[model samples]
Target: MTLLPEFITENGEHIRLMLVDYFPRLVTAIVILIVGIYAIRVIKRIVQKIMVQRQFEPTLSKFLADIMIWALRILLFVVFISKLGVETSAFVAILGAGGLAIGLSLQGSMSNFAGGMLIIVFKPFRVGDTIEAQGVIGTVSEIQIFVTKLTTGNNQTIFIPNGALSNNTIINYSMAGTRRADLLFAVAYDADLKRTKEIIQSVLTSNNKVLKNPEPAVVVNDLTDNSVRLAIRPWATNADYGTMVSEVLESIKLELMQAGIETQPFVKESSKK
Candidate 1:
């Protein structure tokens, strides 16, 4: 019984010593964790505001904010653990190894993620922009973290991986705000070339959609064995390009027919001969 009391007294003294040494550290760790969390929230809000003010893409902005938040949280956790008198070097090494393994396992996805980051940062194209890349021509509908969605003219949806898209050539038609319509018309070899050119030019110039500054051009592009190919090039706003081409072709055909100009390929005329 005397030995039992002595043992209890020794344990109580050891417990008191441990509490004296670690209680402050525990309180400090908790305080750091709480403060770190609050700071992270404030930083996130500030970053979001800055991105908004800079007109950053919504998808990119949110993605970047999340990345920053998680990175800060990891650092805070490390600090909290260290403050509690726990060794962190081994923990950090393990994290590094795990990250490497994950990265190696998802090499392709990581490449895509990096590509997406580049795209979001540089902004070669944006949503609603008409772009031709990876052999697909369509308007960008959405830009996600790993893939970009495009909507074709026929309402088809295409999802292109950001990795390939970033590396490939991207032709942005809508960026120029204007597009040139290249139309070809074949006329009989016997037809008056000068008169045909004048008719085509008139049809283009009469259209309100055609831009006046560049001036519509009607040139003899090629002389084939049977017919003369006339190239009519016109500049029009992107919005008017399709409609202008249709209207111009119809007008040119009607005008040439009224003038008795034959549009039949010379093969027919040669056959008749």
Candidate 2:
């Protein structure tokens, strides 16, 4: 069969197109897209594996992995769209607008994310630790994206927003291996200072849970108008602090009472330091 002349323009340009032009291009594009998606998935898996293998602090690792995945996907999408000869400037403009809207809506969440990053980097405390923050005392249960979870001594679970945590003062009691337990008592002027000191020492010494290295201390700190002020200080492990201190104080009061050493009344009487 004889072929007809190609379509010609007045400018002396001619065009001859293949019958498979549109379909072949479409198929090629589909294949590329498929391969690209597969690559992205593979990369994501690799990232996840690396993060897991490193055993990074879970909260921090997850955050980093998420950022990696997001950046990868966005870049891939942009590249694919550009391959189709699409106007990327318009795409970016639209994305910018959408991102702005989303950001406005999620400002608080983003603040929390920033806070979480700060916390992970600084490492003021970790999960399962005891801390006092924002005037709340609790054991850290979990550190998450938006908030930190804490379980109080009373078994009450509380969720503190990460931003607030980052801003507030945090006291990590667990960070210190030993904590001082300070107790005060008053005695009458007639009470023997020597006997009182001995009693306090006996009480702290009997508490085996208290740390021995610091050597529990007892001293006559002050003498008030009503009674002689005495101080008892002991060192105990952070874990056993509350129970040990409470028990020691209770024991001393009871022991002194049993020894016929009545607590000096807070009456208007002179005290001997």
Candidate 3:
């Protein structure tokens, strides 16, 4: 009983001595950790504000901000562990090994991450731009870290993976401030070419959306045996492209009909196919 009491008393004294020696360091580490967290938050906010002001991509900005916060937090953790007398090099080594294992296991995720980074850096297209890729045509709604969102003309939502998107051919239709609307209309072979051109020119000139500087082009695209193919090309801003095309097409059809211009009838020839 006496031996037990003596052992307990000695151990208690040793623990008290250790606490007295370590208490200041523990307190200091905690205080530093708290301050460091606040600093990191402030820094993150500043970075976000800068990104917003610079008109950076929202996804890229958020992703970079998160990375910055994590890096700072990791550094603060290392400092805290050092204050607690833990071996930081060993901890870092362990983290590296674990990260390698995770990286190998999630290889696809890493590829997507890399693809997303490449997209952000290269800037193939931006949100609100109309792009055709992977057999889908739509306007870009968002560029996320792992995927890109598209809103189609019919209001369909599409999610494309970043890796596949980066690898495939992306046709951006809105890169040019103005888009050329190419329209083809088939008229009867006997129709007067001069009168047809005049009517088409009238229709194009009256439309405000069509750019007058480049001048509208109405030319013979092809000489089909059954009909005369007229190609109509007009330049309009991206926003007005769809509406202007519809209007031009409708006006041409109505004007041609009113002038008694005949449309080519279906004449299936054996050599046509």
Candidate 4:
């Protein structure tokens, strides 16, 4: 018991010496970690401000700023751990292995994350932009890190994977201030082309939503087996596209009927091949 007591006294002294030697390093590391975290936040905000000044997409800017912060924090943590005398190379290797495991387990998720980054960087489309993608035409409500939300014309909400959206072709209809409304009308083969053109042109001109700058066009598009197809194209503001097109179609039909234009039996018996 006396020997045990003596041994304990010596071991306790050694323990005290170890603490005296390591305590400063521990405190230094903790201080650096806290300071580094604060610095990272400041840097992130600075980056975000710069991006905003550059007119970068808001979603992309914020996402990239967060990535920058997390990456810096990770690097700072490694430095702090190294300052405490931990082998950084082995720690990095372990981190790499863990990351690889996570990556494998969440391959789809990683793909989405990477795709989201690409979208935010390239900015093919933006939130609130009307887009046609993946067989759905809708207004983009939000651009998230993993998915994009769309509000369809029918008021249905669609959640599209960022991976798919990045890979697919997105038609950004709202990118341009104005959109061309293309209307196709099938008329009787015997219909007077001159009269039809005049009628449609008059209707297009009367609609206040149609822009006169680019000018509306009514042309004989194609002579199909059943009828002569007339293409009526008018330019309108993005917000007025859907309503203007619907109004134009209805107005044209009413005008043609009032002018004694016949739509049924488009190909007369004598005109059919």
Highest TM-score against the true fold, candidate? 1
Write down the TM-score of every candidate: 0.89, 0.78, 0.88, 0.83
lDDT of 2 by residue, 1-273 (tens): 223333234323322354344456557667777887798789878988886785556877877877887877787788767666667998889989999999999999999988887787788988888888877889998999889999998899999999999988988888877778777777777777788789878888888987889898888778887778777778888888888877887887788787767676532213110
Candidate 2 structure, TM-score to reference: 0.78
Q: Worst ten-residue run, lDDT, model 1?
A: 264-273
Q: Determine which window of 10 residues in candidate 2 has minimal summed lDDT.
A: 264-273
Instruction: Return the lDDT, model 3, position 167.
Output: 92
Task: Give the TM-score comparing model 4 with the true structure, all chains together.
Answer: 0.83
Pairs of colliding residues, candidate 2 = none
Ranking by lDDT: 1, 3, 4, 2
**Would you list the C-alpha lDDT of every candidate in the order shown?**
0.87, 0.78, 0.87, 0.84
Q: Tell how far residue 243 is off in model 1, in angstroms.
A: 1.8
- Residue-level lDDT of model 1, residues 225-267, one tens digit each, is 8889887888888788778877888898899999999996321
lDDT of 3 by residue, 181-209 (tens): 77778899889989999999999999999
After TM-score superposition, what is the CA distance of residue 69 in candidate 2 from its true location, in Å? 0.9
Better of 1 and 2 by TM-score: 1
Error of 4 at 64 (Å): 3.4
Native-referenced Cα lDDT, model 4: 0.84
Model 3 is weakest, by summed lDDT over 10 consecutive residues, at 264-273
Superposed Cα deviation of residue 113, candidate 3 (Å): 1.9
Model 3 lDDT, full chain set: 0.87
